[model samples]
Target: MAFKSEYLAKVYASVEKRNPGEAEFLQAVKEVLTSLEPVVAARPDLVKAGVIDRIVEPERFIQFRVSWVDDNGNVQVNRGFRAQFNSAIGPYKGGLRLHPSVCASVIKFLGFEQIFKNSLTGLPMGGGKGGSDFDPKGKSDGEIMRFCQSFMTELCKHIGADTDVPAGDIGVGGREIGFMFGQYKRLRNEFTGVLTGKGLTYGGSLARTEATGYGLCYFTSEMLKCMKNESFKGKTVVISGSGNVAIYATQKATELGGKVVALSDSNGYIYDKNGINLDVVKQIKEVERARISEYAKRVPGSEYHEGCRGIWSIKCDIALPCATQNELNGDEAQMLVKNGVIAVAEGANMPSTPEAVEVFQKNGVMFGPAKAANAGGVATSGLEMSQNSIRYSWTFEEVDKKLNDIMVNIFHSSYDASKKFGSEGDLVMGANIAGFLKVADAMLAQGIAY
Candidate 1:
């Protein structure tokens, strides 16, 4: 696609020509830049001042080697990366994913998305993300611990409560966060909210684990109320990914009077004619660490379907893509629209493709971009930082109430940003503009670092 802004086109072309084989990172930059064309065009000072160029690139990119001894005394070496993409609003804040899929491109995409997501939260946080190609799915506890320790040995140098705070993503959950924080404390000899998503015994905030999932539904409900004059009451929801986000999204939606019909993982999906029993689902994923297919076996009436892609083919009133990026392509989006899926709120980062998003917008489906819909996790992370600074924790209800307000405020901010930017109903445009303006202004104020 051709860019309307010549400056953005030049930047994209320069990035592509200078860095060969960076397709993933370039694609992420293009998606964001496309949305920002109008914003940059209207505010020529941003482009003239080189704010677009700086925003496209990271402030600092750290790459290090992590060597850890496994339980069997075998040394495993993996790469660790922290892309402190931007720290304009405040410190660099994002998650540390530990999937085998982790790379500079993947981290860039996530961090780029995080910038807007954090902005929507009305929190003082910029965007950044880090992780490794190390897969933790089948690893033992000791092995996971060793890997995290090794990873943190290098990471601790670049991060802090007020500098860059990392949280959990795909593989970096409670267990991973604990191990990483332990290493950081041991090395630095200081206790702080250098990371979010810690175990409750530590500095982690209450309701932090369920914040993203619950927040997604909260934003979705508000969108429904405003657009369709409806709520989650008596609605059927289909969610993908049985991980923290998906599981909790199901729980919150159900609690709000919606019935979750389906949930899936990388392995497959389980469809229950009745609402999925959240307890059983949580037990399987959280305790046993089993595939989602086991949910059907636990319940006699449920059907287990192999392959994650097929979950979208199921019929439902609302759809939450809680899995990975680009999971819902144009074809699956068409399927959802045809199957009477009235609303689509992204629980994962950039789960929908540009084509899929276009289809949803054209069809008038109430679309919530991941930045606006999934800001709950990071917003709560910021709250955790607050607690750490003050040396106190809020009750679960208190944290949840704050999360609810933040999600609602994010909805309003994005909605208002969309209208102001002349794309009233286009959330993609709204999120990018709302997020970019703050970062751009900050970058402009900070000026170029020589």
Candidate 2:
């Protein structure tokens, strides 16, 4: 199958012209569109209807100036962005990340990935993303609150419950969401489902924080089962990013009898032969907001390495790259294969480079792409929407069970699509085609809104 669609060329050209400096977003779009070449070729309606062109570029891109007073009374200004990429199926739904990496390019890349990720979840939610470059790493509560309030002051005007809803990502957690939502409420004077991932008292869903990580493990478990295996029992696991997703993945894996040997952050990783003490790790990360290297000091017989990339060198039966994109490359994939690693499920969007994916597939290692594995966050966000609409709250166990079922179904869908498209074991292709077809058809039916 060759790229026969001239429309793809035009679309890529348009993307290039529109986004000059956003290399990451362009790369993400190119990777996805390259996979959808066959679909675009077979169904010319997508091109004729401008779906491909429109899909590459976001529907709305918002850039606002967020000026807030720090604790020192010095006004700090940072840029805030919200890229509403698509809303064909439903309202704009995604997370609001606050980190030093937050930029138009990063937000666009994340939002572009979210379009297909939400589609694969089989939920009636569109794709969007919002964030700021304000790092919450060492900020005080007052400073964070002021920054979030200022960020939301402008963002509140554009978003709503059924129009565009935002959750939390990276540095934007329950606390950040609370501050943003409170500001929105103060401005608009309405307490609604304008945001997901809020505190339970403020209309957030149960199990939302743990959903992505648990969902990642559940998706990996399903991937293993599809390869004719059991659960993650007795498997040695290595996880990157000691954030919410990694921590929860560790929690679920340990609960399922898998021993997580390593967990890392931007600063470093801590490896414990006896398995990471997740409780202490949680306290250090969640409560104290400390670096992952601190875990070795609290736990005996553990080694700490200061750098995230070093975590990939550890031997494990399962490797969950729960950090950022392109964290794993061909060499790491080869090393994992040589070390007898059986599975690699991405807990972050496009965590593996193209070469890494090729190496893993060539070696027959079970690889779950981020669109399917990391979909739990958005899927649960959709569930949160459902609960909001129904005015009911599900218990943690109930929500978790449903999340597991959804991940299982997503895996089967990818497996079936791969087999149908002559890439039986390659879920990356399966997920791309399946997700693309869903959104493409929907867009076609909706007609050109722009």
Candidate 3:
């Protein structure tokens, strides 16, 4: 169980009372607050200055209606949101997700998590997240373009290169980013780096697509080496989600001598007794835009399950939940623990429930919280912002090397922070306290108005 100080509990109770029914936001607040008991005890000034209260609340939360016409000439309305959670370090930086599940609660949770994730990267990025409840899965290009244009019409007024920079997440991808960037340029009447995950032809950095996944593996490998004197070599891995994060994680893990046995989409998961072939998976997913079940049809000696959760049932040395929030619950954690799983690293924000996290810790599974493990994508985004400012683009190798170094540093900082706080190896508490101290100190220095 997480340790919450008396003051921290009061702040959390206030957060719950103020934001009723926001389960995702409440869960995120609880997770981070519960980890900060020792920090609060050590530094009473944080409580005196109301840092926890102010940090829990966003600086600005914008919600707007996005009305666009579809291919069938029908006007569709969707809800859009941008929760600029913090700006103590720099501009608000996070990804914009486009999915049916996008909401205020989800955006707030992601934004809150981003504050710490961005801080851990040792970059000058504050935390923010924006998205709409618009599903891009079945939409035509024109429809998506129209929706993006309308969405940005409202979004442009609030964002600038030096203000808020949003990248892609979930249903938002290269095509959607292209559309949104084009619209932002048109509306703002300026060509600037207001968004990331751009095409290489424009102001996009190399290796941005693979940053999050590759970073996750790098962080996990460092954690393994530091805690267990092991690496990813010859380990069997299971990854959920067939999106960019999962695909690239599989690629990097395989490159590091790990055998990724399974990958999943929302519909189901595909298991390969042999190692997964990245090329075929990319072809099916990136080129064909099909589901995970299609891999079983094309690849030999592969099996497809009917549900996404069953992928956890496969025995593996490493498990990376790259899917949406709360996708891996307590039962799944128990299953993985029973199957001799040694490590679980999140590639998605808050993918593991509190109960699942407890199970992993109790069973001696080395756990990497999403904020620390998945900070690579935004770290590279910060690099892209730097490149854009200097009008220079680095090669893929250059960006990747920087990203790998950042992940290694993040792991050590978290490990050392945990040790300093007497937790020794609790990355979850270390990440929370390390990131919170950075932001809290900045906020206190800036005064209460921030």
Which prediction has the highest lDDT against the true structure? 3
Residue 417, candidate 2: alpha-carbon lDDT: 82
What C-alpha lDDT values do all the predictions have? 0.90, 0.89, 0.94
> What TM-score does candidate 3 get on C-alpha atoms?
0.99
Give per-model TM-scores: 0.98, 0.97, 0.99
Ranking by TM-score: 3, 1, 2
Candidate with more favorable, higher TM-score: 2 or 3: 3
| Number of clashing residue pairs, candidate 2 | 0
Which sections of candidate 1 miss by over 4 Å?
none
- Is 1 or 2 the stronger prediction by TM-score? 1
Q: TM-score: which is higher, 1 or 3? A: 3
Candidate 3 per-residue C-alpha lDDT over 180-212 given as tens digits, one digit per residue, 9 for 90 to 100: 999999877899999999999999999999999
- lDDT score, candidate 1, position 287: 97
What is the model-wide C-alpha lDDT for candidate 2?
Answer: 0.89
By lDDT, the better pick of 1 and 2 is 1
